[model samples]
Target chain A: MKDVYFMERDPYAPIRHCYGISKILYEGKSKYQEIQVVESHYFGKILILDGVVQFTEKNEFFYHEMLTHPVMFAHKNPQNVLIIGGGDGGILREVLKHKSVKKAVLVDIDKDVVEVSKKFFPTVACSMDDPRAIILNEDGFKYIQDYKNEFDVIIVDSTDPVGFAHVLTTEEFFKYVFEALKEDGIYVGQSESLHYHLDIVVRFQKALKKSFPIVDLYTTVIPVYAGYWWSFSVGSKVYNPREISREVDVETRFYSDEIHKNAFLPPNFYQKILNGNFKY
Target chain B: MKDVYFMERDPYAPIRHCYGISKILYEGKSKYQEIQVVESHYFGKILILDGVVQFTEKNEFFYHEMLTHPVMFAHKNPQNVLIIGGGDGGILREVLKHKSVKKAVLVDIDKDVVEVSKKFFPTVACSMDDPRAIILNEDGFKYIQDYKNEFDVIIVDSTDPVGFAHVLTTEEFFKYVFEALKEDGIYVGQSESLHYHLDIVVRFQKALKKSFPIVDLYTTVIPVYAGYWWSFSVGSKVYNPREISREVDVETRFYSDEIHKNAFLPPNFYQKILNGNFKY
Candidate 1:
C-alpha cells in the first residue's frame, strides 16, 4: 500500500513535522477545535487537534506519565485533585493511580473531545467511568472561581496558549488558581518548549512567582510536539518540587525516583534561560 | 519575497523536518557528500549535508558545547585530543577553548565542508587556523589505525552512522579507537536520538562496553535534529563521567558545573532503554 502523510500546520513553530499515516481512523470538527485520529506507521494511533498533535499511542505514555506522576509524587497526600481542559481523560487515568486520591474533578470547555476520546481512544479514556471521577463540561477558568482552598492538586493539561487557552496563562487565571488551592497545594501547567517559547515560559514563570512561594520548571522530550523539548511550570504554596516528598510506587513506563530528580533543569541553566543568556 | 522550505530527507528518521529558508547561500556536491548553506528565517544560517541539517548559527552552540566539554572536563588534564569527521570546525572551536590542551587533530574525508564553513560560518570555523590545530583531509577509519595509546581524548563528531560513516559505530572501529587512546583516555561520540534510535544507541553502548571499563549515555535537546532528544555515548577507561575531574572555567552557553552532572541518564533509565523495556 502507498503511504499517506499528515503534514502538521503549526503557525507558531518555525519548523513543521510530517507523519506517515497508515490509515485514518477519524476526522471531524469539535466545537472547540478540529479533531483527528489516524493510525500512523511510525507513531501508531495519534490524536490531533486543529492540526496540532496532542499525543500518540506509541509515545503518549512519556507525556502522560511525566506530566502526571511528578506532581502527584511531590505532594504528601493528594486526596482532592482537579484537572483543567483534559477532556481526553489521560490525566484522569494517571491521577487515579494514586490510591490516596478520593476524588478527581475534570473540567473541559469542550464536550466533543471527551465523546471522541471515549469512542476512539478507549484505553486512554478508561478512567472517565471510575467512581472517583467527576466530569464537568464547562469553562475551567470560571469553574475554579467557586472554590477557595479546596483542592490539593490542580493540573492544567490544556493545549497551547493560543485562542481559547491563552487566558490560562494570564495573571488573573493564576490568581484564581492560587485562591483555589489549599495552603500546601501544588499547581502545574504545560508551559510549552524552552527552545522556541522561552519568552512565554519566562512570562509564565514570572506570573507564577507572583502567586506562589516556590516556582520551578521541569522538562521532558515529546517527539510529536513541534518543539520537542516540552516544559512544565510548577507553583507551590509550601512544598519544594526538587525533593519527592512521597514515595513513588506507581507502574509507569518513564517516571522513577531518579528520573524525578533528573527531569528538572539545573539551577544555573534555569537562571540562564530566564535571563535570556543562552541563544537559540 | 516568497518563502522557500527545505524539507529534510532523512531515511533513518520516521518523521521529517521542514525549515523555512530565506536565501540559499551555497549548494554543490563535495567529494564525499552534498553540502548546502542557506539563511533560515528562524534559525539564522543553516548548513545542510545531503539534505540533512548539520547545524544552524542560531543553535549550533548547544550541540558543540554539549559534545565537546563533558569529555574535556572529565579528564584531569587533556593535552592531546583527536576529533574525527567534524569538518564544519564547530567541534574544533570548542576544543581550542581548553587552555590545557597543547595539540588538537581533526580528520574528515571532505575538504569542501571546511572551506564552505570557513566562508559562510566564520564563527564556527574560526579555530581552523589555530597554532595547535591540525586539519587532515583523510578517511577517519583509516587514519586512526596508525595511532596506538597516543591521545588523551578521542571525539567522534561524525554524521549519522549510515553510508560511509557506518563503520564508526562498529565493534571493530571501537577496538581501533580504544587502541588509539591512552590508558585512562576518554571516548565520546554522537549516538543519535533516544526517541527513534534506541537500537543504535544500544549497539554503540554494547560496543563501547566491550572495549572500556565504563560506558555511559548522556543527552541534550538539539532543535534542528529530527529527534530533538539526542544522545551521546561515552566510554572511559578509568574516570567516572558522573563527576567532573577538572573545573569548568571555559565560556559556554549551555555546559556548566550543574549541567555536566545532570546530563547523564540515570542507571535505571539506561538499563530500561538498553533492554528495550521502555516503549517510546
Candidate 2:
C-alpha cells in the first residue's frame, strides 16, 4: 500500500526518494492534463509526462542548454529548422534565438504536452504560441516522411525511446529523417546512455552512419534520464552541425558557439568505434 | 540493513537500477585504490577508476581514447607533460602513445593507487612502471608549486573536487598549475558535471579563466559520474589546445585527429560560462 501511494505521488521520481514530493500547486486544464509544481525536497521534479516540463524549478537551463545549443550551433547556417517530438515547446523557444533561423516547425505526438508546458514551465517552454511556430500534433516520424527536404536542422526532442517514442530511433525512422533534410542537413536526437544502453547507442550510431556521411555521438547531463548522462547521435550530410556558423545575434543562457562545437565531440566509445575497435 | 547492503554493494554508485559495481580484486599499498572486473553485467565491468582501467574482458581503449586522444591531438607538439592525481597509471598509458613526449611526470596524493593499478589493471595502466615516467606520491599542488615553468601539458585526473579533493580547483591551486607550466602549456582536468554540479564546474571555469588566458569546457560520457555526462575544463597559457597537430599516431582506440578538435568544442553551458553567463 505504501509503495503504491509512493508511486502515485511520484511515479517518475527516483525509487528511493519518492516520499519527498511536496505539492506547490496544481491547476486543471480542459485539453491538457494539468499544471503543477510538485517539489521534491530531495530531488527536483518537472512532470513532463505528456511532453511538458510541468514542474521545472531549479535547473531548467541544464536541459534547455544541452538539448538546444549543441544542434543549433553545429550547423553553418540553421536557417530553416524542424523540431520533432518537443511538444513542450522548449526546443522552439531555443530555435527562435538563432538570427539565421527563418522558420521552425514543432511536431509532437500529443498537443497536450505543448499546452501543459506553456502554462507551467514558462521560463523555458515559452514561445510555444509564436506566430512563426507551426504546431502539428501527430506522429513525428510519419510527419517527417511526408515533410519535404526543407529543414536545414532537425532537433528530435523526444522522451525516453520507450512507449510510443521507441520507434523514433529505428532505422526506418532515421532513413525518413535522412530523406526529410536538405543536402547538408543535420539530425540531432537523444540516444540514451553510456552504461546501460551502450549497445543501443552503438546500433543507432552505426545505423545513422550507414544513412549519413558523418555520425557523431555526444552526451549531456540530464538528472531525470536513466544514466543522467544522455547520448545524442548527430547524423549529418556534408555539414557537421558543429562546423556551421551563424554570425546571428541571439541571447542564449546556456549554449554558445564554443559549446556548440564541443557538443559534437564524441565520447571515448564512439571514438573507438570510428577507428574499428568496438570492445570498449 | 538491506538499504545499507545496497549502498555498500554499490558504494561509489550514485544511482540504482542502472548501476552495478565490479570488485577491484586487489587493494592497498601503492598510491590509491585499484580494482578488477570481477562483476558487472551491464557496462561489461572493464572498470576504470582513478584513471586506471582494467581489461578483464577486453582492451579498454574507450577510457584512454576519451582522455588522451582529444587533448594530445589538439596540442601542437606536446613534448613535456605533467599529470596531477592520475596515479592509477591509465593516463600514463595514454600519454606514452605520443612519441613527441620528451618527459612525463605523474603526481598523486596516495602512491597506493598507482601501485595497485600497476599490479592489477596493467593493459590500460601500461605505463605505470615505465622508466620514462616520473612517479611521485606527494601532493600534486605542492609538486606544481615547486616546478615553476616546467611542463608543456598538464592533465588533472584527480577525484571530483569536493570533500578531500576540493582544494584542487581553488584559485591558489590553479595559480600553481599556471605557474608550473611553460609559456604555452595547456591544462585539462575533470570538471565534474553540467547536470548536478554546474555550480562547481562554473566556479572552476571562472577560476581557470582568471588563472589562464584561454579556457574551454567539454564533456565525455562516464556512467559512474553524476549525470553520466562528466565535464572537462581546459586551460591554456598562450596557445589553444585546438591548435595542436591532428596527426599524432598513437595506437589509440577512441581519440582520432578529428576527435581532438571536437574535444575543444564546448556545449551550451560551456559557451555560456566562457561568455560570462553563469546563472544556469
Best candidate, DockQ-wise?
1
lDDT tens digits, residues B59-130, model 1?
899999999999999999999999998999999999999999999999998999989999999999999999
DockQ by candidate, in order: 0.82, 0.23
- For residue B40, model 1's alpha carbon misses the true position, in angstroms, by 0.8
In candidate 2, what are the lDDT values of residues A1-280, reduced to their tens digit?
1111112222232222122355544445424244344545444555535333322456555566667777676677778888998777777888887777788999887776666666666765777667777888888878888966888888898766666777888888888888889987889887876545667777878778768888887765565554455677788887655564555366765455555555554456456655556544
Cα lDDT tens digits for candidate 1, A1-280:
3457888988679898888888988999977899999888888888899998898888888888888888888999999999999899999999999999999999999998999899988989999999999999999999999999999999999999989999999989999999999999999999998888888889999999888889999999988888788999999998888789887978887889899999999998898888877645
Per-residue error for B161 in candidate 2, Å, reads 2.4
Record all residue pairs in model 1 with backbone atoms less than 3 Å apart, i.e. clashing. A280-B58
Estimated TM-score per prediction?
0.98, 0.69
Model 1 chain A worst lDDT window (10 residues): A271-280
Which run of 10 residues does model 2 chain B get worst, by summed lDDT?
Answer: B1-10
TM-score of chain A of 1: 0.98
